[model samples]
Target chain A: MSDKSITRRDFLVKTAQGASLAVTGGLLWAYLVRQEAKAQPYALRPPGALAEMDFNAACIKCGQCVNACPPDILKLAPAGANLPIGTPYFEPRTGACIMCPDIPCLIACPTGALAPELKDINKARMGLAVIDIENCLSWKGLRCEVCHRDCPLKGKAITLETDPRGLSKHAVFRPMVNSDYCTGCGICEKACPTEVAAIRILPPALVQGKIGDHYRLGWTFDTEITQDFKPSEQAPPAPETSGGKPAGMDYLNDGGGL
Target chain B: MNTPADLSHSKLVSRPLGARLWSWRYVVLRRLSQFGILLLFFGTAHWAWEWPAKTPLLTGNLSASELFGRIPMADPFAVLQIFLSGHVLQQKVILGAAIVLGFYLLVGGRVFCAWACPVNMVTDLAGWLRARLPIPAMFVVSRNIRYFVLAASLVLSALTGLAAFEWVSPVGMMHREIIFGLGAGAMALTAIFLFDLLILKNGWCGHLCPLGGFWSLVGRTALVRVRFDKTTCTHCGECARVCPEPQVLNLKRLEETGFVTSGECSNCGRCSPLCPEGSLAFDLRPLIRKHGAEGSISSVRRTK
Candidate 1:
């Protein structure tokens, strides 16, 4: 073979090699991105953050939000943290978001990863706080209501539901989270007195469930209660009399056979 | 013509200490540029360094940043990838990307790789060590492979609905991890270092970096370029020896164009300082035009 020219077999082998290498590398790189993008579903983002998928796509991973945070609670997730690399997140257990009135982090965000439309910090939903009933001091018939007391929205976000203990003079007040008012700022989680934090913050998508439109409670005033099922106009005929003894035997009037 | 013996590396080393340090002026400036950028970001984030207006001096990593609470800057290639992923970026980030794009269009695009990229420091160290270690290359790959990788990154970003290269880029990993805090991102840097040091020479930047490939394409219309004087050149091969992207130093092409014409030339200022014949120097495109016209007139007079 000439030094410059290659045989057809050589050309085929080279092409095959290049194609296989490209396919292998492309698959591995794609897998890495997929894993990184969905690494931590439970990670709590800064206030006004977009939905998880949108946040992942939109965040440039600059950490400006981390700098703007007044309480220094926000951190850009480094690699191996199991969150998307360089994306800003906060751990409520250590340093919860203070729910700054100004919402500096949201304002500092160059991208709309933290939605700019969020003017009121009170409405920002970073995550949902879910109480572990088994471990909660309030649920165990105690007077501890630290979570409710420390909630930024106070009575509106978390209301106490009074329940009388069985035959006991004292009552237990359970802290109930109102989803409509709860901002998920995580101040309540930080205030919980439990050793391991009974009230923990979680991404709403991970914990919140939707009630589909298929079912409706008729008792509720909002439910229209459409009469989709109607009864037949003519009722069934009355049962036929078995005998002429006034349709049935009168046990009380019958004489004793004995 | 002067011989190669007149401009040996030994002669440079034998100069006075001040003169010898002067020879490394570009290298020192490059290191300062790289670390100084990192320091500004780190100090603002960690130490709360603020401007007179009480905003951060510089916030964010190299991927994106806000300077003095007002000016926005972003990586154009990264933004492009994100755009290709079907995300409608906010006006701030889009404007930031445009500003950066326009700046790189004025200067050479690969200026970021040589001056600002933290990964460049790691790769440069690996290259320095590789030259001294006598390690044999384990493989050979064409430099054009980076262009292919660049193409694939765009295609994959569209296909996957994520910025494909940003997710796994060692450049992002090194800078972000350093400024924020250390993490497993260092592992990627280590892999690139070893690959460049032992497996291949200048493997990451020269052969496989899609970001570098993107910048190389942008560099085609750059105003600043390395001017080459063919008459003074002795073909001693000194400039090519020190060059990271040595293929850009093709003597025949330089002789024809009177300047480094290839977009792949990074304008790193490495070859210019070390040129034995003093043939290579940084020149503006407009100045080169005037010089070309004057040289043509002089040559016409000589013919007469």
Candidate 2:
């Protein structure tokens, strides 16, 4: 028993066992975590899937949490990203998390990987997406607030752009995003509907966050737009994997300009 | 740890210690088991989740859209892919033959314990877990039940198929609810496993699953089997008690009288190490060199 007590060799054995256990856990995690098959966010689940967020590494490949996401804000990396198979990606167009006290996606994820026991979305660790000045339409002297109107935080994440000259007979058409209030919900990007979307959401790494606390959404200068505007229907579909059209996405064709 | 088995028949003479000292590579066999099981766990779970995502083109003989029509092989036996479906008494006859073949011809009833039955795997796992528990020691059942259970299962499966004895065949339930409709009536199955594992040790394989009945019969005439040197027998009786299957061998007169063997023995060698005398040895030869014995060597528990 004394020989079994804390010794360097014992420590090494424990570490090796722990390492193997962790790898096994990462593998076995598939069951314990409950990661499920996930199609694109817009497609319907076969009726029994819950969505959740990836809190551990924010990069699982399963995509369930992405689908169950209330906003349809999540997307997967093209095919191979370092993230876990069921990791969640965000899309802003469908709807924002709305900071719904319910946090449906978190509940849906079989793995706690996405779930934060925290009581609120405001508290959950989905990375915050901020507006980049170079990409914001308003920064380029164009009309935009798609980010402002769609954000559940509303006035907090965004503010109205008033008509400086009082040019018309109605409420100012100017739309602006509050650099301070934005949660990087990305609803704005999905909501923008721009050709090369003037406002877009990027990974949370875009801004450094405080440990144990959400990094507040911040906007900065980051963009290079070179495409002319076009309606979504007219926009060519995004290219897809070599396999058949993915489970929930349309295959992009090489057909000339739509 | 490497098995200390002596494969050579010429090992009657003592060997020099220097020649016998060879270090062995302790490849954790269980790690492979873990890897395989983990792969299955992840693969099945994740794959099953996707099954509902895409409408399957073909689910067995039933077409995708034909969710409400006749299926080609919805019978429980087909679903389980186990015994051929038909009648119970015939099944008994088949199981009885299978047991005989295992003992006399094919080595052991491994197929019954390995591939065909799910209860065996579950019990194997339970036995592993039982090692660390504070509960009472394990009690091995007589091996005769394997053939008995197998015979009973087949006959019952046939009976159920013909709409006679429905409650007895677990195979039918496995196929009908688990394979055909799937996720159907799993509650009944889960309850059975819970009862068998928690309340009784390996109860399903040892007592409930009739498929085990078939294997036990087969193992009896197995060419290689556990033999005891009664001279070393302190008569601790652990061999008799811990034997996973009953009627394995007679502990008292193993060397002299030779225990009755048949197709049903699994050759698990539970009694080998438990013998403090190390008198028990799994040998390649017959336990009793006696053809002088005139009992129709029972292949299974035949009413005794």
Candidate 3:
């Protein structure tokens, strides 16, 4: 712990090296984890799901999506250890939603979180959920194939993009879908739990057609769907010394605790 | 690095150990974690260093679970994978937590709050910087904010099918902002750093950071912890002095059993390292068969 053991300069360099090593080690662990990892995608979409939410800001992560569906097609989770929280998905354990008419799940949402229309009921309106370059399991150098076969937006939203550079030894892992033909079926959305969904639904009501959030801000942040968190109406006042307490009471002040 | 024999031989020497039945924790777990973190570093470095050379926008490993339906409702990493995929507030949260928890576990909690998380580091820097700048008045928010956040995230997910806060959540916002709002947020971040460091020492842990709140609570049930020797009791308040947060002493009290202030401790071990008496050593275990088995702990406050 002494600076004399290693010069300050040496310590900084070692820290940098340690930082790199630590990160590399973690990623290696993930890959090693992938080697033994067993979970796989459900082969089909639940029949009862309404339109899915977008990848980014679409769903508010309220857990209502999971509650609404009786078939247990929905599950909510956030990112990380025991982080069983945000971002709802479909499990389809006992029963799939089966593209039920009237989309019971969508109707339950108090917040239009899910699209009002079911995927096959008519034309779906969700925008496509895109994969990120940083964490797309495929991008992480692993070969993942859950987005394709499981997509309700099968032909359109959950398709693939190929490597034009011809560097990859295995180029056959292609899965892309057409956005125009795709309905914002949450099959892809509900299915995604990895850091990001390979495919997602954009709910038409929140997209261009009827999606409206001040239309002006829409011009700037089109990528964003709903604009919530507008300062809680009863915003509490910042906490401070109460009752105009004598300046001596504030522990942060000179005379208070010192 | 060799164990500091000299440091171990202070006035308050730890009585030599006999065949204690169990410690449950191991230094190698940390080593393995370190090794793991190292691999992740290289992977990301490889990704960043070789990005232009080879990029795969779609189609990852078929072997690994893709989006959800692939594995019913099991694989925990499945949801996490989706979160970190960088589409939303995709930060290296898993990696950050692992490295910090892993590396620091070998020593203490410094890594959890320092080495791994960019946000914690940044806030720590801000907490440090405030000493040099026109410090803003610091404020303390509800400690349960992270749970509130976790709850909100779940509620939001159910409502939207998306992680709504992944953008607003500090970690999420930091990740997205860095990649997308890089240019727009430079000055803002700098100001935040200064404010956080100078005005709110460890504000991310004490006031902000939902994740820290999350881990601190769970980690309290940790297999091992720092144990303080009372035979050489000086009550110097040294542990209290070096401590970065309130409630840690009471939290560490053996009587409290397995971190009474579980969520409060960051495991930084600052107090242990700084003690002149060398009275503190890490101890671990769940609550014993009987309460107050250790008698009144040195860490107990007058009120608690």
Query: Each model's RMSD to truth, in Å?
Result: 5.3, 25.0, 26.6
Q: Model 1 — interface RMS deviation?
A: 1.0
Work out the TM-score per prediction: 0.90, 0.32, 0.38
Worst 10 residues of 3 chain A by lDDT: A36-45
Enumerate the candidates' DockQ scores in order. Answer: 0.67, 0.01, 0.03
| Cα lDDT for residue B262, candidate 2 | 48
| Superposed model 1: Cα runs more than 4 Å off | A1-16, A166-169, A226-258, B1-16, B292-304
Q: Which regions of candidate 3 are displaced past 4 Å?
A: A1-54, A57-258, B1-115, B131-162, B175-188, B251-261, B286-304
True contacts recovered per prediction: 0.71, 0.00, 0.04
Whole-model Cα lDDT of every candidate shown, in order? 0.84, 0.42, 0.43
What is the per-residue lDDT of model 1 for residues A54-154, given as tens digits with 9 covering 90 to 100?
A: 78878888888988999999988887889988889998988999988889999888878899999998898988889898999998888899999889888
Error of 1 at B61 (Å): 1.3
Model 3 CA lDDT for position A233: 80
Per residue, candidate 1 scores C-alpha lDDT tens digits across B55-125 of: 89999988889998889999988899889988888899989998988898878889889999999999999
lDDT of 2 by residue, B1-304 (tens): 2222221112212434432221001112323443443343233323432233442211221000111112111222222212322312223223333333433344555333433344344455665566456556356554344444444445433433312112223443343222222332345455555645566665666665554554455455566655555443455455565554545455544556454354445555555544434455445545344322422232211111
TM-score: model 3 vs. ground truth: 0.38
